[model samples]
Target: MPLYQNREFTTLMTLKNSRLRIFLASCILLLGACASNDELDSQANAAEQQIYSEAQKYLRSKNYDMAIKALQQLESRYPFGKYAEQAQLEIIYAHYGAYEPEAAIEAANRFIRLHPQHPSIDYAFYMKGLAAYSGNSNIFSRFLPTSESSRDTKHIEEAFTEFAQLLARFPESEYGADARARMVHLRNLLARHEIDVANYYFRRGAYLAAVNRGRYVIENYQGSTAMADALAVMAHGYLLLDMPELAQTSIDTLKVNYPDHPSLSDSGEFDVAQVDEADQSWINKVSLGLFDPPQPPQFNYEP
Candidate 1:
């Protein structure tokens, strides 16, 4: 072979080898990049799963604040994962367990808005109602002479509405029976509240207002225990307003339904003063000097 040809052949081989090395290096770098991404994804998934598990553990131990934090982290980190919605629901439960009613309501509302078709939506509604119900009560209800029916019922009304929605939408829900029971209690409470307000009006020389409130109770809550007292208030209010016909009608209804009611006399005429003195009895006035005399449970007309 000629020397120049031999040298040219060696040069060609060297160039081919150099190109092969560069191609192999490029392939290795590309493979390394893919592997790195997979590793990062696996790490992210692990972190999310770990956080969710931690939240569950916190919940089981009743550490609601910790559970809320862990759940929030999981949701923020894995917003599109299968566990994201579940975590959001858990946050609501955690808020409820922690006695954070407003936060629980907000979270429940958010869940309902975001996943209207979710299967566990009933749970959200139940929790929302439960939160409202709890929020309506205070420590004073148990200790004071104050009547619950006479207090503000805004939260109770809100709760009743929520429970009603739940029952209407999901008749066979697991929470249906409990919600129904609460509704019954709430209805009674509202009826009694109307009676309380009517009694107040009757005491303040507002006969017409008292009659309206009493009539409302009769029309809206005919079966309630407060109906007897409501009828008495109506009869007395009508008598004071010089409406004998309406007063006679109320007296007749009261006699038929509540023959033993204290507001009535043997003659069946409205005896307003006797009922008033009984309401101011000394037994209810002895509050042991701790608070104002316990207001009598029943109100008596002063007309």
Candidate 2:
């Protein structure tokens, strides 16, 4: 329309065109960088394949050391490629299958640290626990410590800890089911140990001490087969301390809870009337002022 309006319109069009050109140039530069990265990736993939192939052959031949070296080389060459993850798992297996327990665990741990979000992270944890399990030896019993060679149970516990962590963190993992089955056995052993300590205190003359120890078994190991015996021992201990109320309470619990409960009497199982008859004899012979059994014999052998 007007000359000034035309100039302004031309200026706006030019600015728009410049902005569009700048955006197009940035896109071209981005594409060029992507192409360069792809080319490098292609070269890396080829080298990774070579290293992986060699490592796999070594591993298959049971040459763990050589396999480890080749896998390590692959890691150094292409640290972030698909082959890198495969190499990492192979390294763990190499150390594990070769009986290098500590190295296997370390390799598995390293894989986890580096690839925390990996879909196969559960496998890494399971492998670490397996390494721990392989290291554990149950050769020595707690008794005969001097003669028996003691096997370190640390690895067993560590294995269990790692397995439990896997189950807890990745419950849906395939390994979680097996982890639970092993835990059942470990927990039972611990429960039995507590019962043994309780029985030890009960055999001594420490009634209060026995009561406390028995309580541990009852509270902590409710379903253990030893629980009924523990409750019975606790009741006996309470009776010794002249606390008939607690004793009766414990007895009631024992009878209600344990269908096959132990005998309440410590000496032996007998009828209530027989128990009273035995008590009567005990009172007659021991307590003199109130009532005493008559002296039976006084014979003179003098001429």
Per-model TM-score, in order, reads 0.73, 0.49
Please give me the total number of clashing residue pairs in predicted model 1.
0
Candidate 2 residues lying further than 4 Å off, grouped into runs, are 1-47, 57-66, 138-153, 192-218, 221-303
Cα displacement (Å) at residue 177, model 1: 3.3
Error of 2 at 89 (Å): 2.4
lDDT of 1 by residue, 142-189 (tens): 456765576688977988898899999999987788778777777777
Evaluate all candidate structures by whole-model CA lDDT and list the values in order.
0.77, 0.66
lDDT of 2 by residue, 122-209 (tens): 8788777777766753324212232111234466578779889999899998778766755554444344444455445655767788
Give candidate 1's error at residue 131 in angstroms.
2.7
lDDT at position 298, candidate 2: 21
Q: What shift in Å separates residue 128 of candidate 2 from its native position after superposition?
A: 3.0
Q: Give the TM-score of candidate 1.
A: 0.73
